[model samples]
Structures are given as C-alpha cells and as structure tokens.
Target: MATISEQNASSISPVIRLHRSDDVVIARSQLVGGTVLQEEGVTVSGLVPPGHKIAVRAIGQGQPVRRYGQIIGFASRPIAPGEHVHTHNLAMGEFQRDYAFCADAKPTRVADGNATFDGIVRPDGRVATRNYIGILTSVNCSATVARAIADRFRRDIHPEALGAYPNIDGVVALTHGVGCAVDAEGEALEILQRTLGGYVVHPNFAAVLVIGLGCETNQIARLVEKQHLEALVSTGRLSTYNIQETGGTVKSIERGVELVQGLLAKANDARREPVPASHLVVGLQCGGSDGYSGISANPALGAAVDLLVAHGGTAILSETPEIYGAEHLLTRRALNAQVAEKLVARIRWWEDYCARNHASLDNNPSAGNKAGGLTTILEKSLGAVAKGGTTNLVDVYEYAQPVHAKGFVFMDTPGYDPISATGQVAGGANLICFTTGRGSAYGCAPTPSLKIATNEALWQRQQDDMDLNCGPILAGTKTIEEVGAELFQLMLQVASGQRSRSEIHGYGQNEFVPWQIGAIT
Candidate 1:
C-alpha cells in the first residue's frame, strides 16, 4: 500500500514557490537540527528558521525577491544556489519615478443594482451609517466639561427610541492630546482645525456642541470663520453652543446637557432607512500582527474589502510604515503607473525617514508582535497588505485628507493606531475595521470601529473586546472567505446602529492622536 503522505493536511503547506520560475521557501515552523525540505522530487534546501528564506537556486544583485507571488525586495548581492537570503543580502530598491494622480482612477461606474443598508439620511445629502450626537472640545481645558456632559447622559438615561428619531444613538465626547501650545499657522494647527471641522460636519453626527475654555490657541471662533459654519446645522437644525461664552463650568455643563438632550430628542426621530452600500466608507487597518496575520486576518479583511467595493462602497487601507515592503504589489495595481509611482515614492521616503531618525523600519513587529510569532517588519508588512484585497490601487492620500475615490485607496499615516485612525477618520471613513493578531484595545472617535481578532485564543480571552474571531482559520474550522463575509456583515450591523463592544465600553475618543512631527523647541 502507498504510504500515507506524512505532511500534516491541516498544517499550512509551506508556500514553496511564489513565482513559477523561482525556488525559495519560507519556513513555517522551527526546524529540528537537520531537517531537509524536499520539493519536486528534489532536496531544495536544509532547515531554515521560521520567517527566514533559503534559495533553491542562485540569484545575482538587482534580481527581484519574490514572496506571496509579489516582489517584496531585491537582491543586494550575489548568491550561490541554495544559499540563505535575507537582510544581509537583500534591500528595497530605491528609484525615482513620476506620479499620476486620478489618471488610473478611471471613474468607475458602480453596479447600479445592489442591496442597500438601512442608514441615517443626513441633510447634507450624504447617507450615514450612524447617528450620533458629538460633544467636541476646542481645547484641553474643555475636555473635562465635555466628558462631564457625556457622563450626565450616560449615567442618567438609557435611550428609549424617541418618536421620529428611532435611529438616534447615544452621546459621545471627543477630546484629544493636542490643541494647546502649538503654532497657529503650522500644519498642526491646520490639521487640528480641519479635524475638528471635519467632525463637526461629519455625516455620522446628527448634533454637535462645541465646548471650550475660550482663550486656548485652537480657537473655536477661527474654526467657525474657516468653515463658514455660523449657520451650523442648516438641514435638520439643532442647538449649537460654546462653553467659553457661558459664565463658567457649572453653567456650561448644564447648558451643554440641555442642548444635547434636545438634539437627542431630534435625532431620535430618525429611523434607519434603506441606502446604497456606496454610502459606507470602511477604514482597513492592521495592528499587533504576527506571522499568521498576513495569512489570516489581513487577507481575510482584504477579501471583505473587495466585496464591499464590489457592492459599490469604499475601503481605505492605511499605515504608511506597514506598507513598506509590499508597495510593489500596490504599485502594479495603481490606477495608473503614476499613482503606482506615488506609492513607490512614499515607500522610498519612509526609508530615508527611518534612517535619518536613526531608526529602522524593520524595528517594528514590536515585542508583542514577536511574542506572537512575527519575525520582521517585512514579514509583518506582507501580511498587512492582505487587508486591501486584490483590488486595483485607486488613489493615494496624504495624512487626514478627504478621500473621494469610490473603491480601495491608500491613506498616509504612522503605524500608531490612534494617530492613524484619527487621520483615516478625518479622511471620511465612516467605520474603522481593525485586525489584531495579538489583540489590541483600539478605537476611533466620531466613526465607529469593529475589531477582528486574529487568533481564537485571543478572541475567547478578550471576548468582551473582540467583535470577530478569525482564529478559526488556524484551527481547521473555517476558510478566510467565510470569516471575511461574516466580518462584513458585522460591519453593516455596526454601521446600521448596532453597538460594538468598543462603543458599549466607550473606548474611543481617548485614542485620537494626531501624528506630531516636529520638535517641541
């Protein structure tokens, strides 16, 4: 009788060939002292450390390095057949290239017929997946008052579906780290102002009340002057107030709560009505990832993102640092080669950025990531890009800028989740979808966030925080496609007024971190 193949059927058969013409394999697990890998009836190589690569053939300098069927890097030196290939001999190719914007983002004509989610219709003609009353602080001095106002509501009342406003969600107070002691004309001021302005005008918010101490540099009046919002809430009109103009904290809190209550009454009149899927903007992000992240959550999320795009919605893939190694895959799919080149340029910029700061892009895969089995940033990045799916690269955006592209687009941001999600939120993401392999307690203000867990143990351990468990893929229970679709469904529910664990626990707002890029001096 033929011997049963000893290769464990449930274990991920190591992808030994990424390109048909290539011959290198990544180690799936740590090898015993003298393990040998056999491929195509030939001994390809001996045991290699997990996450390291070994060649079955020779490569020369300038030759492309392939992984996951994509160009991950290039050979920096000559290598004999069957030699180990890694950082010592490979590096990202730095090149100059032209960028084309919107050239390849050919206005996609979305499929006219598609299912619509029940959503909150905004007076701005923008369909919103959420209906929230936002209490915004213009400066840190107002942070306490803002939180106090929210507390009054959360502690005092359980929302009863108000007539005509059955869709109204609870109150949220958004406070942040900045808004004090910054240059008035610098990028920080502009970003801080725009972010505040953007949230005030956000479709997800039905009512917004500004709270501030008045003298702070991030003046509410300037925000009013800039956005021409003297006529605030022109559509389904509601109360707009500022605390500084009020006598003091006690009066401001009382007045803010009254205004919030009235707005809640008005917002409660709204009911979820059917709207096209295109109204949804999902922010795709990955953090606390491991070796299995790319193989599981990221790709699974990518598949879900593609499905959302197919249904005529939007998906934003962010975190500039995380995109480092796999930018080539994104470049090829660039709406145009120029858009492709733009992405390539960003990748190149990050290289010098890290080098100058005396840091290494590979310095990531933090202690947590390493403990969870990730070996390098390249390994992490290759997994992170899987969340964007196989969609054509449609557009690239700078930090926190508006994204009007209909399909998948890239947003520039640091790998830090708070700041990254903050930018994505300002860029018009209605909902943030985050995947974590080692489990992260991440949240986004104004916009709702749904967390997808990478491993089952982590999911079960943190069931109160995790919204979706992707560990089934590792447990021989489910496929990436199925879990992905399930996640998409959960996203729709959250968009349509279902409270995620984060929302229920009020875990957002505190996480808003703008990418601060200057010296304090």
Candidate 2:
C-alpha cells in the first residue's frame, strides 16, 4: 500500500492512484473521451465524471478489481484500459478473506499531555459537552405525550418558557417507533430497553423523564431495573410515568410538564468546567459518500481519530454492514485475539442476518451513494474503514451497548445513519463527526454533530450545513494531517459550547431512530 505522503503527491495529478497496484485511477474532474493521460499512456475512451473511476489497465472477465491495493470486486466482462469501472461492469463475487488476527497490531504512541475542553461535569464524575433535559418514550404510544412535555419548554414556541433558566440547553424528546408487539423475552425488547436506558442516564442530560404506555411490552419499570437505573430514580435524577397510570393522555402530558418544570432549577444549576479531552467520545460517521471520501474527509478524520486516541480520548467506528469487505483491516489492529474475534463474530452474525432476510450484505451503496460514485459495498467498505485511523482496535460491542473501553473501539450497527448514530450515542458518544460527499443533512440531540465535506464543490454548494472542508486535501493545497489538526482543534471548540451547523439549523429531534429487530407479533 502507498503511504499518505505518496498519495498526497498523486492528489495533485489529474487522476488519483491510491496505490500503485490499483487497477483504476479516480478522475479528479470530468474528462471527455479521447483525452490523453500522458503519464499512464492511456486515452480516455469515454467521459468520466469527477470522483468516478477510470480503468488504467485491461482486466479480463471474472478477474478481481483492485482499489486502495485491495480487492473491491470482480469484473463482469472484459474491461479495456481507460474505460469506466462501475456497477455495470463490476459485480460481487465470492472471495476468501484471511483474518490474520493481531498481525498488524502496534502499541499506540501516547501524547505528552492531555488536551482540555470546557465541559459540564456531573455529580457522578461523567463529563458532558451539552446540558439538556431529555424526555424519552418507552413505547411509540407515548411519543406524543413525551413530545408535548418537551414542547412546553421550547424557547422557539414560547420564548419566555425557559427565560429564567439560561444554563439548560433546550428540553428534547427522543421517541422511537417500537415497544409493543415484541416478545418480552426477545432480543428486540432487550435492545429497546438498553437504548432507552442509555439515554436516561446520558451525561449530556442533566435530568431525564421517561414516559410510557402502561400496557406496552416495554414496561418503564422493567427497563429501569434491567438497566440498573433504580439508583438514578431514587435520587430524582430520573423520572418515569405512564399514560394509563396517570389517568390518560391529557393528564399524562400535564403531569409530565409539571415534573419537568420542577426539575428545571436543579438542571440549570449544572455548570461547565475545564475537563480533559478523554471525556470526549466522538461517534465517527460517513454518509452520502463519493470516491473522494477516502482520499479527503475520511482519511483526514482518521488522522484526527489517531490524535484523539494519543490524547487518551475515545472514538467509535461503527456501521458493521458498511465495513463487510474491509473487516480484516481492523482485525489486524485488534488489541488481542479476543477483541479481534469479537468483531469477526459480529461480521458473521451480520452475514447470517442478511441471509435469513434474503438480502445481500452488498445491498449497500444506496442510490445516492452510487450517484456519488461508490461502486460496490467492497469498494465502499475500504473507504469507510479509513475513518478509524491507525489505532489498535480496543473493543467490540453490540448495537446500543454502552462502551466502557477507551481508545479506538467498534460497535455493531446498521449502515442507516440515524439508527447507527443512535447506537453510538447510546454507547456514550457526546459528539459526532460526520463526513459527506453528496451532502447529508443530519444531527443528534444532546450531542452536537459536526459535518465535514469531502470536496470543495459540496462545501461551497452547502456551506450552511458544513462545519469544515477537507476538500483542500483533494485540491492539493493541504495534507491529511494538516486538515486533521484543524479538525481536532475545531472539535475542542465545539465541545466547549460552540454550536455546530446542524445544531444551529435544528436538525436533531427527528433523527432519533433506534434499531428495531425481532418478530412484530
């Protein structure tokens, strides 16, 4: 594989060759047919769009196609030099992956000193980047009542509602669609309870209120007990109520509003203090990805992740299905065989899960993703794994499971942005760094989300939603490390109370989607 320095030099050329062994070179910009590539000694056979692939060498039918010096797919038919390589000509094929556990694991080089940020320290010693009173629903039935309770404190609706409590970030209602018609003893219910429990005690929430539909399979009491939240309830930090028990919808809403009002003064008392950067748990996400994602934003974010790990901070790399073909890269970086196997186990589970559902793991690279130039899941996975940086894989966790290990970790999650991010947030992420090439409008409450653009065109077209532009790296004006350092500093500033672009535009409330599994009956 080529080094970052070597890749940087290629970025300045008309096409980017990630590795010398790669069969294709990415078009830096649109190139018309017959354009000569003086370096590769090939002429463009047809038009190639920016961020799309252009074959630099002839590939025989059924032969493996390479990118980043790794197999991305197999050619479906003969492909001549300078031809376009994409879904139409390249297709999925069986391949054996060598999971050489711990083959490339290395000790992390710790930095000299820890970085600091202005954070809110809770009584339990957990640090928070934002302070809010969260309202969670145990069932879809209680979603409305939960929203109504939070609506009372919305500064937008009633400017004077929270006029006296300046320290409290707005009250937010995080509601999900599944809580009933699920077996009480099934994995689905357990996952739901775990997800809600995580939010109830999240550090960012100064206090939390859980609303439920008394008859739902997901009882609030059961969730509290299973998640060991009895202590929080006993201390008044967490509160719960049900519409049926509270005498119906109107009564439930009124009671909820009253409870939140009573908790305001105490919630407002929470203050920000200087805290070490180790308290920052950022969830790394990439959406609307294009070819430039790996070359620019993703690698840049990975560099930032390496810095964060050096400073004792934690960064989570998730979206298991998205990393299907590139799991070996991570397994080799595992801290031990146990950690590596855990990740492999998740991959195996996903394979079985997809098979049972009559779906293929290669079903990713959605329409938007393909439109942005992604070919197969293998190709996408290779780029996706770049966000984890070069750190050792310290741990692996199930969806919505709380992350206890520090440094770099992996969480099993779907490729859907909302559901994936929700799991990360549940596992204690207080911030999110999302990269996009086609522009994804997303955000998470309690945790501020910073959007990074993969190319300058996307940045300039959607500047309002983007917080940083890694496009300079692709433009040959900056290196990955430089953009990474800049992003790291920006992260600290956002953690210190600067609102992200998504936050400023209010793109969070509607994005709280929990992973739903198991039989509906």
Candidate 3:
C-alpha cells in the first residue's frame, strides 16, 4: 500500500510514475512551464505533453531511463529534473534480457467451478458465442462471387424474416486478397491453408460455403486434402465450388446463395445454453497505444485475462513484433521448458523475417504512438505485453493455428493489429478485447470486440465507439483489480449477445488482412 503522501501525489500531482524505481513520471495532463511538483520537489522546466514522461530526478548522460521498473531507453544526453523525456533525448540501446525460462510458472488459484456463460452449443459439443452462415473464398478470383452471394442475403433478409431463424447471426463473406499470385507450396501456402481451414471449422459459423477459382494455384481440392477438410465435406456442413467448374461468375454466385440458404435453417437451429466459461477464448489486442496504456487499461485488461484463465478459459496474447522487447516476461511464465522454447523460437524467426525485409523490430511505435508519448519500441512493448495479465503460459501457436490448450498462450503474428486480430479470430478466439489510448475505430467480423479506453478523456471524446472506460484507474478512483472485475462481468455480457459499440457502428466489414509472406510470383 502507498503512504498518504504517495496517494495524494497520485491523486493531485501533475505527473504519474508507474514504479518507485522509475526515473520518469508521466504527465497526467499538459504541463506548462512554472508548474510545481510539490511531491517530488521539482518544477516544470518546459511544456510537457499529456502521456509524455518528465524527469522527476536529476540524471546524467548515457544512463538508462526506467519506466515500469524496466529500462525503456538510455538518455542521449544529460537530463535535468522536470525536463521532458522523449525521442529528442532518449534512445534505444542494446541490453541483455534475462530469459529465465519458466522461472515464474506457478499453480493458478482456480476460480469456482461453476462460472458459466450462455453459449450456442453445437451438436458436436463445441460452444460458440455467435452463430453465422459464412461464404469463404479460396482465391481472390472468387472474392467477387463470394461477396455477391453474401450481399444478396444481406439485402434480401429483413430483421422480421431473420426473427424466424432467431439463432442465426448473419451471413458474412470472409474474403481475402492473396489466395493466388504466390507460390503453390512452402511455408507461406501452408499458413494460408491453415488459416482458411481454421475458419471453416470454427464453431461460430454453423455452416460455410467455400468458393474457389479452378485454375488458381490455391486449388480447392489441394487445400481440402492438405488441410484435412474432408471431415466437413462428409458432414455436409461445408460445401465448395469452383468458378470455372460452375461455369463462371453468375452460376457460382447462384450456387453459393442456394448453399447458404440451405444452411440458414440448420444454423438457426442452435440455441444458447449454459456452458462453462472454459469455452471462452478471448484474443487480447492493444492499438494506438500511449504511455498510459500499460498504466491503466492494459493492466486492467490483464486482470480480466487472469480472471478468465482462473475460470478455465483461454486468452491469446499476440502481436509478436510489438512484444519484441518483452518476450522474456512471457518466457518466464511458460508452464514448461518446451512452451518457453517455442516462444523463443518464434522471436528468432521474427528477427530473421525482419532482417530479410531490411527492416527492424524497432520500426514500430508509429507516428500516433509517438504523439501519445511513446518513444521507443521497448517502451511500447512493455506496455503492450501487460494485456496478457499474469497467467502461466500454457502454449505457443503458429499464426492461425487452432488453440487447443486453455489458460494463457502466445500466437506468432505481426505487430499490425488487424492482421494479428485476424489470426487470433481464425484460430478460434470467439471474443476480442482491444485497448486503445489514441482511439482506433476497428473491429472484427464474426467476433465481438470490446474497445477499452485507456483514459477518461478519450472515452468521453469517443463515447460512441468506446465500450468501457478504464480512466478511473488513472484517476486513482479504482484499482486495477476492481476495474478488471468490472471488465470480466462486461465480457460475459458481450459474449451473451450484447452488441458492442463497434458492432453498432458497423466498423468491422473490411479489416481482415492476412499476413502475406514469401515472394509474389
């Protein structure tokens, strides 16, 4: 617990320090010159932006700058107390991160065994939060037909008509750009096939219609055989058609519509039943991050994740490049040496991948991030990783691979939020929690995403898009645990069919971006 003075400092000070060991304190709001820091016995030297850091004590050149009790960067030159700490004076430098694999894994305090949610239970005994009929395209050549079929249903079906099939969510066309124009075999193709197959088998989609172009490199037959999709074929839950084989665009679209219409009644047959919380797999995402991200919403989300894991649910932590500097934190929490090694392996692969592209992992903390007071990838990553909470890591998965284990897990994905979230959703994450400090109006289809605002100001400004405000944490009105418990309850409500702000605003129609690796040939 903090002393009275410490509490008062947080409640009334112009700046906020995340850790006692931190050399810098984040400005709670804009600080003009002449403002006094009564608690730290310092005065503002210049204008400091909100979310930007200010030196609370004198520091010399070349010394490490600490935030979250970890080194975010080194001082490029001497910094006086009250001076702003940012890109102009701070720089990224090489440092050793102690891997300390599996050193922090411990038995989780399990929650009461009766935690449950109203989930759509499938005949195969799988649980889903949403029930939708889907049209998936195997190649970009068939994307037009897929969308046309989906659009027809969207335009033709009215709410009154859909009321007849109460369990069905909607018809969605899961189309992508690069099912062709790439190599037919190898790592890239394998990943694509895995992603496609994962979506087809996803329980949320009661049935799927797969469309393909017969002449494309990503032939429907090969994808089916390679991904072992024959089971779906046998069950009649999945149907595939080729544009060329179906005699072109019109015929393909007509056939797709017929197939989807046939699945409508079947998809609507599912009804919500009480199921264990273990059936929930939530994807953790953070975008448009600021310094306050880790301090408030991220940690609050992490608390929710911990709560979910305790209830036997799974939470996926992704955005590999964003986690670059913080991988050690997760490695220490791995349930076994094997899981730890798997995470490390993914990091190494990312290093090689970036090098091959003549890029660096430090090529993050985008313009918006900097404007929000993030200086280095190290600083951004430390904040980003907090979204995973403190659960023991049970597994590590390749991009889009089905997540089988419960509890916390890591997925290999690019730092780009859309791509990362896409991989997570395809991997069977039924719900998403996205924390943003700079306000991003993004969402994912076939999955409900709850947007958590890192600050009250942003929440007030984007009330229509923001689902939850974690601003109280920064205001010293709520502890992370209290807010986390609040978020957990909200997650249950959202999972059981409460529409999120994004869903209401129709923000998730065109954000599916699969990672395209390998040469385009």
Candidate 4:
C-alpha cells in the first residue's frame, strides 16, 4: 500500500503489493482530470489514470520493479518515490525463460462430495449443462438447408405433426469459413473437423445431425476417420446427409427435417440428475468496457471466478487486447515458467502481428470506453485482467483452438465479443460469463451465457439482460466473495438448463462469427 497522510484515507494505494522493491501502486478508484492525491509521502506532482500505476518508492538505475510478486519490468533511470509510472519510465524487455516439463496439476480434491448440480447425464461419461438437438452444417452450401430444416421442425410454429419431440430447443445451424477453400488435408481444415467433432460429443447436446454438401472439401467421412467420430454414428446418436448426394436444397431440407425429428425423440428421453461441479467450464469475457469496469464489475466477476476454481471447476479468460498492459500480473501466478512463457510469447506475437498489419493494440479503448472514463489501453487492460481471478494460469491456447488447461487458461483472441465468444465455444467452453460496465445485452450460441453488470445502476437499467449484479461492490454492500459464491450457484442452474433472459429472447443462433485469421483471397 502506498503511504498517505492521515487526513486522507482515500489517497491510499489501490492494490496489496507483495514486494518491497515495488515502485508503483494500483489506483483503487478512478483518478480523472485535475484530481490530485498524495502517495508514498510525496507531494502531488502528476495525475495517474485509474488502473494505471503511480510510483510508490524510489528505484536506482538497472533495478527490478515488482508487481504481483514478480518482475513486471525494470527501471529506465533513477526515480524518486511517489512519481507517476507510465510508458516513459517503463518498457517491455526480453529475458531468458525456462520452459521445463509441465505435467498434470494437482488441485486438492474437493471434500464436498455432495456439491453436485442437477444435470442431464449422457452415456458418454460426460454431463450435460443443457439439452438441445443441434443441426450442424458441414459446408456453407448446406447452411440454408440446415436453417430450413430448423424452421420446419420448430415446435412453436409446427406443433401440428411433431408429436414425439417434447420441449425441444429449436435447431441451431453451426456454419463457418474454410470448408471449401482450404486443402483437404490442411491443418486449418483438420482443426475445423475436430471442433465440429467435439460439438457432436458435447454433453449439452442431446442429439446431432450433420448436414453437408458432398462436393465440399470437409466431408463427414474425414470427421469419422480423423476424429474417431464413429461412436456418434454407431450409437444412433448422429446422422449425416449431404445436399449434393440428396438432390437439391428442397429435397435436402425435407430429408434433414425427417432425420432431426428422429434424433429429437432420442434426446427427449434424458432427465436431469446430480452431477459434479468440475464438469462446468465458465468462459469469462468482457466487451465494450469502460473505466467503471475494473473498479466494479470485473473484480466482482473475478471473485466469482475464484469460487468456481476453489470448487474444482474451470474458468477461462480471453480477449488478448483487453489484457495488454496487465499480462504481467497473470505471468507471476503461472504455476510454472512454461505457462508464463507461453503467455508472453503470445503477447510478443500480437505485438509483431499488429505492427505487420499496421494496427496498434492501444487503438482499442473505443468511444464507449473513453466516454466511460477509460483513457488508455494500459488503464483498460489493468481492469480487464480482473476477470481471470487469482488462480495460476495453467495453460494458454491460440484462437478457436481447444483449451487444454484446467482451472484458469488464457486463449489468444481479438477483443470482439461475438468472435471471441465463438473461439471460446469452439475451444470447448460450455458456459460464457461476461461482465460489462456500459451494459452490453450480449449472448452466445447454443452454449449458455450469463451476463453480469459491474454496477447497480447498469443492473437496474438493463434488468432484462443481466443475470447477476456485482454492483454491491460499488455500493459497498456485498463483498466480492459473497457475490462470487452466488455466481457459482447460478452457473449450476444454467448448466442444469435454466434459461437466461437473452436465451429466452433467442440470443444464441446468430452469434456465431468464426475468427477469420490469415489472408482471404
């Protein structure tokens, strides 16, 4: 904590620093224009942005500056205590890293064996968070056919003939890029097949129908051979038909509708029962962030993330740009140096990636973010990282790639909400936990998503969209731990098939925007 006069308790440093050689203090509240506060026994000299740092102690040349109990960076020159710390005095420097053997993590076995949620268990040794029959398109050529089949089978509109299917969530068309242009055996094509393959076995799915255009590169046969998707076909849990093989769009849609109706019959037989909380993987993301986000909603969500982790569950944090200046915080908590190295390497790649593309990572604090009092990418990043909680970063992954780590894993992705959410879903995340200060009424695909508001005002204002309120942290009413426990409880309900407001209003079907990386010809 930074030193301050007794006359002003409000002038205290924001974070609990673990290192004695630290020269900076995290801002607890928004430090806006013209507001001066004394820190570390120094007179007011310069203004410090919220989520940014102010020097708390003096450091000589070539000294290590610590935050989160590790070297985030080093000093540029001699600096006195209580000076503002920004890009001028700090820079990103490379250091030798040890990428040693990374084995299975030993999270202590939770003694609360009774901590189970009512979930629909499947025969595949996996538990379901929701019960939905999915219509997945193998190629863009079959997208319309898949959608048409869904339209004809929706119980709400066509309740006359679909007598066997009961309470069925309407069909979702999972379509994407790279099914046609890529080489048949390429890595990109292989990744797409596995992602779709994973979804067929997803516990949330009760039944699956694969719709394809036979002429396309991504044939369903490869999915079986490459990903061993034959189990789905053998158990009568999945069926595949192609438009070119059938005839035309009209004939394919008719065939798809009949096949989906049969799958729906098998899916409706499932019922919810007690299941462990460890099956739940909450995907934490935020978009349209503002200054209030770090101080209110993000940290509150962080507390919720901690509860889930403590319960032997998993929480994933994504959106690369959102974590720009705050990547160092996560690095120190990395269980081993390899996980930390993987995270930093991704950051380095993004820096070079931006430079090559003529884009700046800092050019993101959108008009909405600026209006909400966020001044820089540095300030927003510090706040945005709060959603990951205090857990060690166990693993890291690329865009739209499967998340291999348990507890807390970082996936590299752009800050766009819809695309980022898409990558998370493809990475095997079943539930998305989103926090917003400016109040985005957002939702994702077939996977259930929970919206949390950063403050009380946003929660009340957008009562219909928000599922939980971290506003008490802003109002000094509820501690983060209290709100976090409640969030974990709500996750179980969501996993058990309880509907969020956005889901009730049909939010999942259209949010699928795959990350289109590399050059498009």
User: Which residues of candidate 4, in runs, are more than 4 Å off?
Assistant: 1-114, 159-164, 183-187
lDDT of 1 by residue, 255-296 (tens): 887777667666776667878788898988887876557666
Candidate topping TM-score: 2
* Model 1 lDDT, full chain set: 0.72
Candidate 2, position 438, lDDT: 94
lDDT, candidate 4, equals 0.71
Cα lDDT computed for each candidate against the true fold:
0.72, 0.91, 0.87, 0.71
What is the per-residue lDDT of model 2 for residues 1-521, given as tens digits with 9 covering 90 to 100?
Answer: 34344665654478877898999988888889998887788888888889999899999999999999999999999999999888889988889888899998998989887789999999989999999999999999999999998898898898798999999888999998999999999999999888888888889999999999899999988999999999999999999989998999999999999999999999899888888888999999999999888888999999999999999999999999999999999999999999999999999999999999999999988987887788999999999999999999999999989998889999999999999999999999999999999998999998999999999999999999999998888878888899998999999999999999999998888899999987898
Of 1 and 4, the candidate ranking higher by TM-score: 1
* Candidate 2 lDDT trough over 10 residues, lowest sum: 1-10
Worst 10 residues of 1 by lDDT: 1-10
Quote each prediction's TM-score.
Answer: 0.82, 0.98, 0.97, 0.80
Model 1: how far is 435 from its true place, Å?
1.1
Off by over 4 Å in 1: 1-66, 69-113, 155-166, 233-244, 344-360, 475-477, 519-521
Provide the RMSD of all predictions against the true structure, rounded to 1 decimal.
5.5, 1.1, 2.1, 5.4
Model 2 clash number? 0
Best model number under lDDT: 2
Tens digit of per-residue lDDT, candidate 3, span 1-521: 11112344355767786778889888989999889988778898999999999998988899999988888999999999989899999999889998899999999979965677899888888888888888888888888898888877663454554666767878888888888778887777888888888888888889888899888888888988988889899998989989988999998888887887787787877888888888999999999999789888999999999999999999999999998888899999999999999999999998998899999998889999999999999999999899998889999999999999999999999888888998998899999999999998998888889999999899999989999998888878788888999999898888888889998876565777777888878
Question: Model 1, 491: alpha-carbon shift in Å?
Answer: 2.6
Greater lDDT among 2 and 4 belongs to: 2
